[model samples]
Structures are given as structure tokens and as C-alpha cells.
Target: MRVLVVEDHAFFLLGLVTALTGHGHEVVTAGEPYQAEKLLGERRPDVAVVDIKLPPTHSDEGLRLAALLRSHEVPVLVLSQYAVPEYAISLLGADPRGRGYLLKERVAGVAQFMGALDRVAAGGTVIDTELAAMVTRAAARRAVLSPLSERELEILALVTEGLTDRGIAERLVISVHTVVTHVQSVFRKLDLPKTPADNRRVLAALAYLRNG
Candidate 1:
């Protein structure tokens, strides 16, 4: 797949580009958002892997780039050292599909990281498992209404990991119906009025992060 990478750290950027290229994927590298935007305007990419922080601003350049890609209907996978849940939510605000948020340290295994990129490029969300748990715990702490059960919280974490109900059920060795019920309970406890198909997950994630 044709991919674009936007990162500020020179070594990290070079390593990622080299790794991706070695994986047999066409890679384009950009040090900042402006260059990434220019590349996007010139040729649309199958996927964009962006760092949540960048040069000129070092604040939210990657977030902005994700928004730009979303507006253009391009897929995006965000990589960051910190579990900045707010930034992840923003990156996915435009379109929950074909998006991902992964912690940089989690990419230690090239095979795993490349698999995540492939999943995002094929229109799937792939949040890091560790970050998902962190966000879930944060949500539990900040929750105002009813509190989530430990089991419910676990299910929610799995949800943020981009697992389908069936996949979650299989992983947990529970029935699909049980998984669905737990998910519903989680939303209700969190006062997430929106349907699961909507962006309620984002709210839950943000709340979790805030509490943390």
C-alpha cells in the first residue's frame, strides 16, 4: 500500500520509513504537517501514519493532519509515545472507520506494527491494547453517573481495541450475547446515550483519559 508518514523525531521517522519500505509498502516521509499536507494534495495515499506531536508546534500537528486526511476520505493511523486519548479521539472524530491510535513503544515488533497499518489501510480501527486499558480505567475514575463493573470495564477495553463483538466474545470465551449485554451495560453506566454504531466510544475514551 502507498503510505505517508509524518513525524518530528528524525531517527524515529527514518526508522519507520525504512521499516515500512522493507515491509514491501511504498512509503513517503514528511517531517511535519505542512509537508504531509502537500504530499496528500499531490497524491492520495492508502494510509497515513502520523505522530501526535510535530515540529513547528509540537502540540497537535499530527491531529490536524489526521483531520485533513479524514476530510479527504483517507485512512489514518496515529502513533505516539504518550497515551494522549484526546488527540486520538480527535484524529478519529471525522470518521471512526479506517483509523487507528497506537503508542510508539508498542511498535517494538515490526510484524505487529505493520499488521496494524495493514488493518487501518483496509478500513479497520486498531488502537493499542495498553492504551485502551488506560483509557478505560480513566473513564471509570471520571464517571459521574453509574459506575462500570469490572467485567463491563474489561469489555469496554476490548471494544476500544477495535474488536468486534464476536471477536471479543471468542477472546474472552464468553457468548456473543453476553458480550453485547456487557457492552450495553457499559454504555448505560457511562451515560452514553448514543447507539454503539455512533461515536460513543470516543466519548468513553476521552472521559477515561480525562480521569487519568
Candidate 2:
């Protein structure tokens, strides 16, 4: 696979490039947004690993670059130091496919970072569980989610982590039936429109995370 890494930090870029090369991936790099856009104009990589805060502004430049990469048909995985849910929401936008937001600490575990990149490359959503929680906690008392009780919010967070009813029940040490009850209430409070897909749980969680 061809991977594009857009990051301003030199040492981290060195380590990441070495890792991707060791894993048999071809790599292209850009230290900042302008250079990244120039590379994008020349060639689109299979996937892009971008930092949220980039040089010059050291703010959302990398994030905006990720969006541009996606516009160019390259999948993007945002690797950042901060767990800002709002950033994740903006990065995800309306379409979650081929988009991912993972905290930079995951890079310490090479396997985790690669796994997330692989998923994004395959056009899947990869929201970090920690970010999932921050997304909800940050939105607490905001619209849609304001009606949820504490337990419902907890269950919603677990849902965003990709846990099933049974999995959530096991982790929370509650009966599956109890977990289902909480989950049902969560969706009801959010008032999600009925859809044929079984991903209503995910939609409900995303709704809450984006609302508050």
C-alpha cells in the first residue's frame, strides 16, 4: 500500500516512516499543509496519516488537509495528541466511511496504529474508544443527549466503543436485558429515525456525541 504521512514533527515522522517501510508499505511525506497539498496534486496515496495541529497555525491545518485528501479520494486517519471530540466530529463530517480519528498515543503501539490505518484504507470508520467517551462527555447537557440519564450515557459510550448488548452487559456486570433496556431508552431519547440498517445503535451514539 502507498501511504502519505502529513506531520510537522521530525522525530515522530522518522519513526513512523521507518515503521511503515518495515511493514512493506510505500510512503510519501509532507511536513506541512502546503507541501501536503502539493503532494496530493501530484499523487494520491492509498491512505493518509495526518496530525491535527500542523505548523504555521499549529492548529487545524492538518485536519483541513485530511479533508482535502478525502476530497481527492484518499482515505485519512487523523493521528493527534489531543482527544478533542469536536475535531473528530468535524473530521468525520456527514460521512464516516474512509475516515478515522485516533489519538497519537496509539502510535506507541505500532500494531494499533497500523490496524486503524488499515481500517480507514478499507473505507471503514475508526473512532477511538477514548474519543468516543470524550465525544459524549463533552456534549453532556447538550441537545438530544440532554434527556439521557447517567446510565444511558454510560451505555451509549460503550456502544460507540463497538460493544454489543451482551458485551456491554458483561463489562458493566449487568444482565443483557438491563443493557438492552438502557440502550433502547438511549435511542428513544435521541429520537433517531428508523432505518433498515442494524447500525441504529451507532447512529444513536453518534447523534449524542455530535449534539452536545
* Candidate 2, superposed: residue stretches over 4 Å from native: 137-155, 161-189, 195-204, 210-212
Best by TM-score: 1
TM-score of each: 0.81, 0.76
Q: Which ten residues in a row have the lowest lDDT in candidate 1?
A: 198-207
TM for candidate 2 is 0.76
Please provide, for model 1 over 1-212, each residue's C-alpha lDDT reduced to its tens digit, 9 standing for 90 to 100: 99998888898878888899999989888888889888988999999988988879788778887888888988999988887666666666745788889999766689979887887888877777877887666556666323667787788788788776876899899999999888887766666655565234644545444554
Worst 10 residues of 2 by lDDT: 194-203
Error of 2 at 108 (Å): 1.2
Model 1 residue runs over 4 Å out of place are 142-147, 173-177, 188-191, 194-212
Per-prediction CA RMSD (Å)? 3.0, 4.0
